[model samples]
Target: MSEAVEPSEWQPDWLSELVNRSTRSAILSTPFTSDQTEGHLPAPSEQQNDPISSGNSANASQPPLADSESTHIFDYREETRLPVTPSGERSVRRTLKGIHLFVRIEILYHNAPRSSNQMITVNATLGTGLYWRGGQILELGGPLAVLVSFLVVGLLSWAVMQCITEMLCIWPIPGALSVYVSQFVDEELGITVGITYWFTYSMSFSTLVATSAAEFNFWRGINDSRTIQGVVIYFLIPLILVLLNTMRIQIYGWLEVATGSLKIFFLIFIIIALIAINLGAGSKESLHYGAENWGSPTDFDRDAADNWVISLLMSISIATFAYVGVEVVSSSVLEAKSPNLSKGGGNPFKFSAIYIPVFATVAYCLSGVLGTLDIAWNHPHLPRLSWLPPDLNKDDKSPSRAAFVVIALASNIPGLDDTFNAFLVFTCLSCAATNLYVASRTLFGLTSRLEGGEGRRWYLRVLASFGKTDGRQVPLRAMIFSAVAFWWFVEVLSEMASVSVLHVWACECLAFIRFYRCIYQHREYLERENIALVQRWSVKNYSDYPYRSYGQPLLAYLALSGCIFVLLVANGAALWNGFHLLPFLASYLTVIVFIGIWILLKIFRSAPWSFVDLSQPKRVAEIFRHLHDIRLGGTDSTEDISEG
Candidate 1:
């Protein structure tokens, strides 16, 4: 008050000075806000270079902002800073916390959409099938048979991945299997396949949870106690998975990364350990038993020379089941920020498409070879329970009874079996979580089709509600619905769930074949069109085509043939050894259900009887034009295309 300061050079009181310093600190500390404002549009070159921006076509279609709008972009950033207290003073800790919160929000906003990294994709694909089912494959078919089955199935899985990946690179839509099948195949078949696939994952979740409970029982040395295992299986495990999935998808992705890394390390360790054990590194008496088990009786009947063929066919079905999750990467394409773009780090989906089947195949073949050498198929400690019949005991094999555990026990290494069993438990839980995530997302995709329409049907409105996302973009209702519905479904038919995997895969293969036919016909039509139109619409142009799989049309045919062969021989063991009622029903029930659903949908929804007319030039042009627009980062222009 004693000295009058000019308005231009005003000095604040102590409280005002503190407030000003806090505000300045907050703004300066916020990294994103300092460099860029909200709704800040990048230059065209920068947009093309940016992976996230390149993939998000909706942003490219937005109108340019006015000058006033550009300045106001920072207003939200300013409002998020530290608030002034009544006395115009704030604590140092509070100021720091505010800055920390702002930074975290900004970071999450940028990174959350692009959460499906390489590690997560690998982990989600590498499920519990190999760990739990490896011993069974070895037991059914000797080392040679197991190796052959995995190699064959691996080839089929690889072909299927290539076919699905090509289509996904263009569409990248959620619930992609159904949408593609509907467009290129029959509509009723597509809906039926989608529902069946969703059920398959849901049932698989229950199967994996039960498997995890068994692994836990093995760990605790309480195999006879059903009550504790039931509690863990039905209640504890499901609760944990539900809580995990209900959070932001980023959290699920990171969790998969951690678990997937552990499983991969375990897989590497086990393979090395088996090889070491086979080479007499950890043997009690330093006895090398390389290829000794290959000469052991491969067939359970142990009578006929041709029984090995039956065993190989039976094991192929199990091997196919093990490879089921490899294609789940396609399901995740929708959530990925830059699914088709490879500008920055390489595209995750493309990497997964190539990596999963190859790695799974090699790992499976190596484990089969080493596992068979470590112990004979008929060893006393091989975990084949005598109380249950041989045909029914496949579902009862626990981690403790797995071939790895038998080898660990034989190696005379103290606590080795315990350690392996613990990892198996973790693997089972990881796979269960993955299955649940896939199931919920599949359901979310199906329900998404029901959105944005004023529907007369109350049932459709009910289904559409499940598609709605929360503030964090988590499909909470879908997650809840899938969990509840599948939990009860699993309780009723756990055994049948294991068999449904083959049927679901078969449907996927058929869908891919139809997809290939459509693509081939379109290409042929484009070749006959005028050169300018052909150039505009041709998928052969790399600039317009986001990604293309090699050996396509040929690859699609191979996958279809291999899948058909597997379906014919999947239940051969039962047929050869005198058919058992439960196993027979389990093997073919999904087929019956699939056909039933297709018929129902055809009648109620009036789905088309035949596939889409791909030979028509107009249809081909429209399909290619939509794809061209998507490649150019334009709005989806296919809304006018009829569902029929």
Candidate 2:
């Protein structure tokens, strides 16, 4: 059967009450702004041009009259009070209940195109996607697969994220990408990108949770299922989506920047600790064991290189999780404090450009050293190192009780074991937080597009209970929701860890495939939009673009390809040995589930035009605006397309 389907072609449900609820909620609860001062603002008669006043009414009973001051839609006094400022000060000044209705309608429901900077903030403050990918790597990728998967998926994730960001500013939330694209080029492309990203990110998160639990067993000796925690995290996923989305753009942006900082610290500490331990264990212990201990003699056969390549792909897949944050950075560009924009000057793109590489490099180094040490330490019997090389003469013992148990073998400081254990706990917790953040945003984005009713007053009320100053913005809601989703994902993955590795690999393989396809689909948009490009370059400029295979995309492609190949090889290996395929069969079933979801999206839920549907309405407007300004005979000065 054919897999392709037209996008965003769903018929409007005339009889559906749910549709009305979503529409009412969405239209009623648009985040609003006041262009005038309270009280100082003239009556409706004096300020007929006011956008806020034009849209809302202070009194519905009052009849329209030439001198409309008596019926001025918005009271200047109530509207001008600044909502809780971003500086974190709470204004206790309260208005009468009578004026409150006007303020709520005029201020809270003021639906307007937000500044690009504000949009960027919303993208950045929601930082769940980053850690979600990281944990996936730990779970889905094995030692051999980590590096390659990291490089491939990382770049793709970044590009896909940028594509989503560009699409977002065009329509904002509540509309699907297909709807936005339909406003510009066509609906087919919009549905194309929409279904692509939704499936890619969601499936990616799901596979990661499953894989992480399995991977945890490789290092720690605890009962594999019980030892791993946080499967219950995904339940909170729905809530996080709502909260972060409940606010205006600016609030969301600050939240991302702050959370990213915290994430960076945890990542750094782990990198540093892993490095210190690696460095502390020098070649002095090289005499104790030969290379065969880490892998069998058969492992070094000519096929080892192919196996290694596959392993690298798996690693890249795992590491791709770390790169998840880069997309948020790309999305933040609109809200980025551009020097030209009056509101702010910090660009998340710039931060992520530098931040991603630095983080990746640190992680790369940490993984290599840690992986090598792990291979070495996992030997049958060897003296565990105490801040030094392993002593071959000492009794052999595996520090499998806990990852921190390795630290106990190294240091004798008081509570050193506890301290190390605490760090490990913190790492897991951080991972959980990051996972929640990513899952919630993705789900919220999905829900906002899918749901017709926005549930406005209730949403605003939710934000208010948390003491919202102006009663708009739900950062807390988003956070809590994300946490719940994270919990759910963790629970699913942990429970399934006992399943065979091949099964985990299949789900991961499908996820990686979807992720790559999503990025590939957006290549044209990124190039045309020149969303973040500073210069123009041809495919020939990069060795990896089309033919040469050393650069980013090529490396990523090769890695993904290798994953599929190796998965087959691993499965074949088991079959050749006459081993059971129960685990493999189970995993195959999971992959089948994803395939089903994909089928439904392609046939039933796709947006109008695939490529054009990728762009939102506002983005379409922007593109046409720029295109209109271009002189027919003359060349446009700006080049679009940036490094992934």
Candidate 2 to native Cα RMSD, angstroms:
16.1
Model 2 lDDT tens row, 74-160:
111111111111112111111111111111110111112222222222222222223233322322233334344555544443333
Per-prediction backbone clash count? 0, 98
Model 1 ranges off by over 4 Å: 1-117, 220-227, 281-291, 296-306, 339-346, 383-400, 451-455, 489-492, 495-498, 524-540, 623-644
Give the TM-score (vs. native) of candidate 1. Answer: 0.74
For each candidate, the alpha-carbon lDDT, in order, equals 0.56, 0.31
lDDT tens readout by residue for model 1, 1-644: 12321211111111122222322333211111111222232332343343222222232232211111212211100111111111111110011111111111101111222435344445555666677567776666667777888898888878877777666656655577876676566656766767877787788877777777766766554567677667766798789988988766555555665576667788888888877776776664324344456545454434211478877777787677677777675555545543223332223455555656787788888877778778766554454322225443335344337778778878887888888887788777777777777787787766653422252355665776665566556667877777777565533265456555555566666666765565555665555542112232355544445456677667777787777677666654646666556555656666677778888776665545666666666564544443332222211111111111
Model 2 error, position 234 (Å): 12
